[model samples]
Target: MAAAMTRMLQLLLITTLIHVARGKVRVQITNMIGYKDDMNITCQSSDDDLGQHVLSYGQSMEWKFKPNFSKTTLFHCNARWCDVMRRIDFGAYEYMKDHYGCGSDCRWMFTIDGVYAYDSKTDSWDFRFSWYS
Candidate 1:
C-alpha cells in the first residue's frame, strides 16, 4: 500500500529528528539592568559560578564587545554590592552577572549601565557597565 509506505517514511523521519541534545546551559536570559539585547551569560560548572552568565544592562547592553574589556577583573565581592549590583554600573562588576540561580545551572545578567550595541551573528550581548565607579 503506497499510503502505508508513506506513513512508515514519515514515522522514520520524525523519529530521526526527535533527538534531544545536551547543551552547555539551560536557563532564561534575565534583564537585570534593563539592557535591551541578548546576554552572554557564562557557565563555569562550578559550585558557585556554575551557569554564570554575562549580560549588559540598560539600552547600553551593547558594549560587551569593545576591544577594552576583554575580560572581567575581580573587584572584591561584598554583600552591599549585592542588590546594588542590579543598578547599571561599569565601576566594578564588569562582565560578571548577578549569579541569579543557585545550582550548577543558574546565573545572572549585568546592568550594562554603559552599553553600546548587540551582536547579531552570534547570540552574544555587549555593553559597558559604567563610565565611573
Candidate 2:
C-alpha cells in the first residue's frame, strides 16, 4: 500500500508540473551593446503590459507572460537610445515555439543596430529587429 501511495504521489506531481508549465511563457532579453548608456525596455501584448526595464551594456532581463484566450498574440519589446527607439516583435507562441518549445524558455539579445532571438537547440541567434526614430 505504501508503494502504491508513493507512485500516486509521483504521478500527481508530474501532472501538476505539466499544468503549471502550460500556463506561462518565459523569455530573456540581453543587452549586447558596448556602450554604457542605459536602454529603456518595454514589453506589451494585445494592450497588456508584460514588463519594463532599463538595461545597461552587457545586461540582460528575463520576463514571463501568461497568455490570454488568444492564440494569435503579439508581443513586442521597445528599446530606446537617446531619441531613437528600436522595436522588436514576436508572435510570442508561434516564434518562440518554432525555435524553443512552449515548455522551454527562450532568449533574445539586443544590439545597438538590431535584435536577435536565441535558439537553444542550435545554440544560435535569429536576427529580428525594426528601428524607428
Candidate 3:
C-alpha cells in the first residue's frame, strides 16, 4: 500500500516538475519567424495557437527558410518543444484548406504542438476561422 502511494506521489511530482520547468512565452502573428523580418503582423501573448494555423510558423535561432514571403513567430517554450504536435505539419495540415486567399489582409492559418496557457480570448480572423492566441 505504501509503495503504491509512493509511486503515485512520484508521478505527481514529475508532472509538476515538467510544468515548473516551463517559461513564459508570448505568441505573435506576423510574416517572419523571429523578431522582425520583412512582413510581420504583431507580437503578443494571448489565448490559443496563433491563426487558424494556415501556416506552421516556428523560429529557432538554428533553422531558417527562404524567399521570405512572411515570417511569423508563434511561441517560445522549452528546449524540447513542438507545435501542432500529433498533427503532422506535412501530414495533417495538407488535408485542411489551411491557406486562405489573400489580397491585402495577409491572413493565414497555422498549428502548435502542445497546450498553450493564456487568459485572453482567441483571435478570430474570420467568422468561421480563428487564430491561436
Candidate 4:
C-alpha cells in the first residue's frame, strides 16, 4: 500500500509540473513616431478585447493572453491617427510557438510601423517595419 501511494504522489507531482511549465504569450506595443504623432491602439481576439491604449509618441503598452489549445486564436491590433488607420494580426502559434507545444517563452513587440518578436531559445529579435499610410 505504501508503494502504491508513493507512485500516485509521483504522478500527481509530474502532472502539476507540466501544468505550471506552460507559458502565456506576451506582447508589447509602442508608438515610435518621435512625438510627431499620437496613436490610438486597440488589441482584440475574436472572443475577447485584450486592451486599448492611447500612446503618445515614444510610449508603449503591454498585453498578455493564455494559450488556447482547442483552436488557433487570432489577435489583431489597430492603430489610428487622425483619419489614417493601420492594422496587424498574428496567430497564436505565430506569436507564441509554445502554443503548439514547443517549449519557449513567447515575447513580441509591435510598434507604429513594425514588429519585433523575440525568440527566447535563440535570444534574437525578429524585426519588421513599414511606413504607415
Candidate 5:
C-alpha cells in the first residue's frame, strides 16, 4: 500500500511540475479607436465570462490563463464604439492558432481600420481582419 501511495505521489508531482512549466498565457486588448471614443468591450470563453468593460483611447484590458489541457481553449470578444449601432465580434484567442502565432503574450489592437494581432516571432503587428458589418 505504501509503495502504491508513493507512486501516486510521484505522478502527482510530475503533473504539477509540467503545468507550472507551461505557465499562463497573457492576453491584452487595447483601444486605439482614436477620436476620443470610449469602446465598450465584453470577452469570454465557453467556460468563463470576463464581464463588460469600457476602455478609453490607449486604455487596455488584460487577462492571463493557462490553456486547456485538451488544446481547445478559445476566447472571443465584442467591441462597440463611435456609433452605438455598430459592434464588432472577434476571436480574441484560440489555443490552436494563437499558441504558435503569438506565443505567451498575445496583444491586440483595435482601430478604425480593423483588428491587429501581435506576432512574437517577428516582433510586429499583423492585420488580422476588418470589421464585419
Candidate 6:
C-alpha cells in the first residue's frame, strides 16, 4: 500500500536524523578577580537569553546546549566588576573556533589581567586576551 510505504519512509528519515543530531556542549565562566570582588555577567545568543548572574571570586556559572546544525552558533557576553569600571564585552563562544579547541567542554576565566581559556589536552589555562578598555 502507498500509505504504508510513505509511513515507512518517514520513520526511516526520523531515525537517521536522530542518529546525526549534534552533541551538546558545556560552557562555563568563572570569576577570578580576587579580593572578594563580584563579577556580573550577562550572556546570550541571537536565539537565547541566558540572563544575568553575579559570580563572586572563585565562583562560576555554566550552561549546556547543542550547536546549531548550520555551524554558525555564537554566544557573546558582557562582564563588569570593580564598581563597573573594569569591564569586558566579548564573544564567549563561536562554534567554528571553539569546538576544535574545546571539544565539548569550554571553560573561560575572568581575571584582572584578562581572559583565560581552558586547554583540555594540557589541563591548563591559556591566556587569551588582555583588557583593552
Instruction: Please give, for residues 24-114, the per-residue lDDT of candidate 6 as tens digits.
Output: 8899999997868899999999999999999999999999988886779899999988777888888888999987889889999999898
Which 10-residue window in model 2 sums to the lowest lDDT? 93-102
Better of 1 and 4 by TM-score: 4
- Each model's Cα RMSD: 14.4, 6.6, 17.3, 5.2, 4.1, 4.4
lDDT per residue as tens, model 4, 1-133: 9999999999998886666446556666666655677777777877788676888877877766664554365667666664455555444234343454323344545554565666666777777544442
Cα lDDT for residue 116, model 6? 94
Q: How far is candidate 4 from the true structure (C-alpha RMSD, Å)?
A: 5.2
Of the pair 2 and 6, which is ahead by TM-score? 6
Overall lDDT per candidate, in order of appearance: 0.34, 0.66, 0.28, 0.61, 0.88, 0.89
Q: Which lDDT tens digits does candidate 1 get at residues 14-58?
A: 764542122122233344544354344333211234333454443
TM-score for candidate 4, please give it.
0.58
List where candidate 1 sits over 4 angstroms from the true fold.
1-9, 20-25, 28-108, 112-120, 126-133
- TM-score against native, each model: 0.22, 0.62, 0.22, 0.58, 0.81, 0.82
Better of 4 and 6 by lDDT: 6
State the lDDT at 46 in candidate 1. Answer: 16
lDDT of 2: 0.66
> Which residue ranges in model 5 land beyond 4 Å of their true spot?
1-21
Q: Which ten residues in a row have the lowest lDDT in candidate 6?
A: 14-23
Per-prediction backbone clash count: 22, 0, 21, 0, 0, 0
**What TM-score should be assigned to candidate 2?**
0.62
Clashes of 4: 0
Global CA lDDT of candidate 6, please? 0.89
lDDT minimum window of 10 residues, candidate 3: 88-97
